[model samples]
Target: MAAQSNAATAGTATVQGLLSELAALEDPQVRAVNERHGDDHGVNLGQLRAIAKRVKPQPALARELWATGDTAARLLSVLISRPKAFTAGELDAMVRQGPVPKVNDWLVNYVVKKSPHAQVLRPAWLADPDPVVAASGWALTSERVVKSPDGLDVDHLLAEIAEHMATAPQRLQWAMNHCLAQIGIELPEHRAQALDIGARLGVLKDHPTPPNCTSPYAPLWIKEILRRREAG
Candidate 1:
């Protein structure tokens, strides 16, 4: 086990060196990688994303990257590299990482680049004791419903969400807006759950409005989903 840890560390070092070098390269692709790694090489996170492209989908990185990404350095390991899948053990660790707007950033990273570890990110993310992490879990749960409808359990997930609404209203409200922004997010059951939450919150009437949208991206979508809920 110690040897494996060493190997992982060595792999990370190698990747880091490669990324640093990649960062200095003039090529567009290399610069993009640098930008996402926080290398401000005249490119924004959005643009670098278009170029770096994740090597695989998530669940693979759950063990190596997702669970351990709390540290900026560790997260950087993933910015330049990704695991193929998440082990059962890593899921528990991911629960410890506080979810927030940055959590969404990683998801976008995993999604844009295509990490195989996306599967394990949420169940673990939401179960976290931290409301922020739970908010992140909610973020992806909403995304999963859209991108992979057959993949999630809306009823159970929402029940858990309702638990958040009761206990962590701030986080719950923040997640609500995130759910709205993802237009193509298409899990029918999950979408229904989001709408249900919106109706209860009365976003249209400008009442309390499903907790305050703490994250910048949450508002637009929160309003949109509420509109959809009312229209339907």
Candidate 2:
């Protein structure tokens, strides 16, 4: 185990060094935008990705940065992290720490859902008491359903949306709403069910939408996205 111990030590030192390098590259303007998104460390995605490419994939670095680094560092850590390095327990703890929704979104999309560990955590997270965890679970599930809807019980997903979309916490309601939209866009047979659920919730129906973007009011968003997909 001496070789293993040495490797671990070297890994930690390397990641720590990279974190320092990353901190020096921070931008005040980017940090301002990040603060608006609920994380304060103002690092832009392009800069972080460039640095991540230099550091390459390092789960050890990712974990250390996430636990101790600033918001920008943590974002970079997630981008560089190996999906296999994060355990379900670790993810649970991180989610419970009340990370900003944007950070959680990236972590869920880029790390948790991409890992094999997702299958083990999905059910637990969907039913978790923490609203964020539950939201994340739904978000990940929506992605899965969109990518590969075959063999998945689309009926169950639609039923869940109908049951929870109306009353879920704000974050969770958004994810559930997205799930409904995904069903409508991706599953031809279940499009009607999804549209019906969207109609029932009417979630964000009155929310002002940007001029060039489709409204995220589920039914309209689903139709617009599907149309875009077909045109592409």
Candidate 3:
């Protein structure tokens, strides 16, 4: 019992130390940049990744850091936590927490996608009332649209996008647009429909893109990616 108590105490001290490290790395300029992208953290992604590299994977530590509600710590937790260790319900609760865009994106991409529960959680989140949760669901669906699409209804997905892409919330629209692009890029039979729907809806058409970056406007994005593939 004493040994277990000591171990727990040591874990607490380690989490505190990591938190201090993250705080020290924070910068106002970094925070401003992240804020523009809808994230609240100030730590440079390179620095956060460096910290994750030094810290061995620890599920308990990940949980503690995530509970503290610091964006950078949460990002680190997503990196260090064992994805499959989380229960389906726990993942659901985490998504429903509506974390900032970067954290939510990382949690879904890095953690939830690897979970055995991903397929199980996908539909529930897709149907969830919360737009954020639904956006995550769409993100997962977009993955399936590329990697494991035998069971998905491509027509129905396009239908939904056609009906809702123009009016859905920002995050959800982005995710749905991604699914549309995946369909256009990966499946030849649906490419025409996907492109048509994208052209019709015009979502993200005016989104400011950095120089030389592909536009997120689905029609342009689809053509640009396809053009690159043809060039190579």
Candidate 4:
């Protein structure tokens, strides 16, 4: 009992210390900049990564940090947590929390993508009633479209994009657009159909992009990536 009490005390102190560190790192100016992009955190990603390096991987500690629900801390937790440790149900719960944009992006890329249950969860989440959860499912589908698409129904995916992408909620639309771009970039036989769908849908077609950066517009994005690959 004494040992358990002491261990709990130590864990509490550790989380508190990390929270203090994150607070110190926060900057009002950074917060303002991030808020424009729909992210609420103020700490720089590089600094968060550095902190993750200092903290040893501990799934319990990561869970505690995530439970704090502070964006910066949650980002750090993602960096240090063992991705495969989370069950499919836990991951589903996390996605439904509707974390701010950056947190959601990091959670999908850093943790959910690496989970052993990703494949099982993919189709289920894609069909979820919530747009955010459905967006996550689309994100995973985009990954498989590029990396491992043996059994994925390409025709069905394109048909869905044709039917829903133009009217999807903002985040879900973006994920569907990404999947459309990936299909064009990775699948030669389907390239014409992908390009035609992108041209007709015109999603993100005029979204401002910095000079020299590739546009997120699917047709343009697909073409630019193919150009780069050929140039290589």
Clashes (backbone N, CA, C under 3 Å), per candidate, total: 26, 1, 0, 0
What candidate 1 gets wrong by more than 4 Å, as runs, is 1-75, 85-88, 91-104, 107-117, 166-172, 176-196, 203-232
Please give the range of 10 consecutive residues that has the lowest summed lDDT in model 2: 1-10
Residue-level lDDT of model 3, residues 172-219, one tens digit each, is 999999999999999999999999999988899999999999999999
Q: Which sequence of candidate numbers ranks them by TM-score, best first?
A: 4, 3, 2, 1
Which stretches of candidate 2 lie above 4 Å from their native place?
A: 1-16, 230-232
Better of 1 and 3 by lDDT: 3
lDDT of 2 at 158: 79
Residue-level lDDT of model 4, residues 7-50, one tens digit each, is: 23333437777887777779999999999988888998888877
Error of 2 at 227 (Å): 2.6
RMSD of each: 9.7, 5.4, 4.4, 4.4
Tens digit per residue, CA lDDT, model 2, 83-199: 888778988777776468667888898888888778778778888878899898888788888776666677877787788778887888888888888889888888887887888
Q: Is candidate 1 or candidate 4 better by lDDT?
A: 4
Number of clashing pairs, model 1? 26
Q: Evaluated with TM-score, which candidate comes out highest?
A: 4
Error of 3 at 198 (Å): 0.6
10 residues in a row with least lDDT, candidate 3: 1-10
**Cα displacement (Å) at residue 55, model 2:** 0.8
How well does candidate 1 score on lDDT at residue 115?
40
Instruction: Name the TM-score of candidate 4.
Output: 0.92
